[model samples]
Target chain A: DAMVIQNPRYQVTQFGKPVTLSCSQTLNHNVMYWYQQKSSQAPKLLFHYYDKDFNNEADTPDNFQSRRPNTSFCFLDIRSPGLGDAAMYLCATSSQTFGDTQYFGPGTRLTVL
Target chain B: GESVGLHLPTLSVQEGDNSIINCAYSNSASDYFIWYKQESGKGPQFIIDIRSNMDKRQGQRVTVLLNKTVKHLSLQIAATQPGDSAVYFCAETDSNYQLIWGAGTKLIIKP
Candidate 1:
């Protein structure tokens, strides 16, 4: 099945350390997005790549960054992990034609110690 | 910033009953709306979507209703099952195409 995949479903990192989460898709969608979901809260958009253009949300922290080297792969890098950064990181993809219907991966759970 | 929000934080329904989850949006310019279901320790899954031009759209056992006048959207599930228990969210997008998500509603099934 053509779907989104995330690596290291569970990640543990020390405080102030950098961590990277990866996402790959087989659906060949033109848009890839990264969202941070805290406990009992809605998923907040961190950044997204529409083709090669990167769009970051205004409220996203400086510690969060994303890169899409190609259509099939995207990575989220946290410059310095904090205890409050523990949350589920989700990767989603959608075609430009049907941008409303986004397909999401299983998500990576990050735990900052 | 304008965003989408749900009226209720949680709901408990008996198995086989119909469930209705409501959401309100502050962005009147939103042209697209979607409903998503997120299971524990998983990502949000697309359930259904309705464009602003349409008032209703249905898929499988789920139906989405949009009321442009009040900027309200709803998801209706028929014959609710234990498997349907999860966090449900409504999202809206304008011409910018950035989705604004709502605080999800926890749907609890009572067997």
Candidate 2:
């Protein structure tokens, strides 16, 4: 069973188009996070949801938004995909504790044309 | 902002040999540190973690050493295997849930 799953392992979209990436976790973790990683660089936090509370990173662009309908599902919405936004988007989950180790899903590779 | 960092960007070792990866963090208040391994096309997988109160922690084939004095952390893998070849990253978290990540080190296992 996949602990965390991301649909469409690879996604391609045109510039300025709207695209959505979905993530679901079977672990029922209270904390879910979205990260954007390009090439070999460190993954940057876009936003997260702790239960139903949404937290956005200060540096995250306004074009990126997130929604968590329930405990098990989360979605990343790119209102206007840009060439710079083409990268691997990773989804992770963790418990409520600050030190709890996060479990990750296979990332979705996004390509902008 | 202070962030987690690593000295080396890549490491190479032979199979059956030991591998060591080093990381440094400037945030003295960070109470938790974690190590993750990411293979090509996959997200990071948790390998091990250490709490600020502890200086060292070990897993089945891995050991984590934390030197609060120097604000350094390290991961040691015993008898490295081919499957161990991946990008390794260190993350530090304060009392908050937000985590600061270090640029990963690519581990190359020579078989």
Best by DockQ: 2
- TM-score of every candidate: 0.93, 0.95
| lDDT scores in order | 0.90, 0.91
Residue-level lDDT tens digits of model 1 in B6-91: 35498999999999999999999889899999999999998998889999999999999999999999999999999999999999
**Candidate 1 accuracy as lDDT:** 0.90
lDDT of 1 by residue, A1-113 (tens): 64999998999999999999999999989999999988778888898888999988899999999999999999999999888888899999999833458899999999888
For every model in order, what is the number of clashing pairs? 0, 0
lDDT of 2 by residue, A1-113 (tens): 89999987999999999999999999989999999988878888898888999998899999999999999999999999988899999999998844688899999999998
Q: In model 1, which residue pairs have backbone atoms overlapping below 3 Å?
A: none
Score candidate 1 by TM-score against the native. Answer: 0.93
Q: Candidate 2 chain B: minimum summed lDDT over ten consecutive residues — where?
A: B1-10
Q: Per-prediction DockQ scores? A: 0.38, 0.40
Task: Show where candidate 1 strays beyond 4 Å.
Answer: B1-8
Candidate 2 per-residue lDDT over residues B37-72, each given as its tens digit: 999889999999999999999998999999999999
Worst 10 residues of 1 chain A by lDDT: A93-102
